[model samples]
Target: MKAVRLEEIEQLFLREVERPVPGPDDLLVRVEASGICGTDRHLLHGEFPSTPPVTLGHEFSGIVEAVGSAVLGFRPGMRVTGDPNIVCGHCVHCHAGRINLCQNLRAIGIHRDGALADYVIVPQKQAHELPLSLKPDYGAFCEPLACCLHGIDVAGIKAGSSVVVLGGGVIGLLTVQLARLAGATRVVLVTRQASKRRLAEEIGATASFDPTAGDAAAGIAGPDGLLPGGADVVIECAGVAETMEEMPRLARPGGTLVVLGVMAKGEKIQIEPFDILFRELRILGSFINPFVHRRAADLIISGAIKVEPLITRRVSLEEVPEVIRNPARPGEVKVLFMPSA
Candidate 1:
């Protein structure tokens, strides 16, 4: 099997590796497509906490090559995606239906050998069946889409509301689509990338803004300009301290600000005291997918969300290292690796 290994901080290589065997409760998947995420970059840089020497890939979809003895409801040749956040059922969070915050969680790619190879093992409970209507590349997107769904769940978005999503990356673009589905009347996407901004608009954002333009604050303002609180809900998806700090400033009074991106450890953000006190804003942070993978699959199968346009590029497993080195090489949006390609 060929796998992309994270040999050390800021380094990755595609090399020959032994294939893994599935436990009785696990399913062995022949990975077809795997999405490259910011987390992969985080793993390469050793930024986010994780185990070292791990085969890195979590956003993936594949055909079941084999199943453990105990596995049921699925057989070999079944197409599946899965919840990568494996948690101990005994944990308080797990028992409380908050598995995403489980005390003893071990992610496949982040803590073990994931699907960045010809084959990878996933718990049967984590594996989700895919519909024939979906292409494999789109199936790989279920994980990220699940994470975004979890964010919108926590956000409690209301109908006729306005939304502003920071950053025009995959997460931001997904957020825009989810916001529209949540019944938000108008959604604005803000990013530094021109290509991504264009993608954002195509994905249902009412408007897209380049923060680099003069006074982005003004451009983001709502109609009539009476309040800088133009956005009813501000989703911070940039993963930058500056964007995180600006969340409160971009929301309407009594608005909700959800931080959906992962910032580096020990980073700090400055917020004005008045924004929290006078505005009485509701600020929240969104974490991982939280057992929402199946819901995401349903969303995809039912055609409730469209993710085909989010895939900007596809390459073979051998190109994984190079793709990570330069994510901005040309196109923007999610990049999927076809391991068997």
Candidate 2:
């Protein structure tokens, strides 16, 4: 088996490695497709804390090739996508139904061998079978979509609510769709990329804007205001300082600002304390998707959220390093690595 491995920071190597054998309670998957994430970029550049010498893929789906004796409710040849966040069931967070915060959590690809190879093993508890009608590319979105689902849940976005998604990346795009489904009458997507902006409009955004050139939020609530104050909810998916700087302000008084992006280690974004009290704004930092992998799988299967537009590239396992090295790779919104290709 060939796996994309990270031996050190800012370095990724494609190397041949021995195949993994499923242990008791584990299911071995012959990976078909895997999604390269922003986290993968962080892991590659040593921005995200991760154990060294780990296979770099977590958003994935594949056919079950083997199952441990202790595993049940599944068999070989089943198509599946699983939750990568392995949490300690005994932890306080887990008992409190917030397992995403489990202190002893270990994720596939980040903390263990992942699906960036011919074979990947995960606990049977984590695997969710995909419908036969679902394609591999769609399954690869289960993980990220699950995270977005969790964010929407935290946001409490309601039908006919006004929403702003501050980023047009895969995550931001997904949040836009989810907000619409949640009944947001006006969905505004803020992104600098024209291509992504156009795509967001095509998908479901009531409008898309390039925040750098013109005032997107301003256009919504300027003197000739489309919205008087601001959106009811603001989901910040841009892991940059500027968006972080503006999240609280763009949110309407008594509204919510959900932080969906992973901030760099030790990075700080300034926000006025008085604004929270006077505006009575609700600020929340969402972590990983908690217990929503099943919901994500079902949502994808039901076609509740269209993921086809978000997939921008299809590459093989061998092509990953070069794709990661080039930031300007054309149409590289969400790159899916087909390990079996």
Q: Which candidate is the best by lDDT?
A: 2
Could you estimate the TM-score for every candidate?
0.95, 0.97
Cα lDDT, all candidates: 0.85, 0.87
lDDT by residue for model 2 (188-300), tens: 88888899889998889998767777665576655554556888999999788889888876778899999998778778889998998899999998888888999999999
Instruction: List candidate 1 stretches off by more than 4 Å.
Output: 222-228
Task: For candidate 1, write residues 95-195 as lDDT tens digits.
Answer: 89888888999998899888888898989988899965678888888998998999898888889988889988889988999999999888988888888
Please give the distance, in angstroms, between residue 28's alpha carbon in candidate 2 and its true position after superposition.
0.8
Supply candidate 2's per-residue lDDT for 259.
92
Steric collisions counted per model: 0, 2
The global Cα lDDT (0 to 1) of model 2 is: 0.87
Report the poorest 10 consecutive residues by lDDT, candidate 2: 324-333
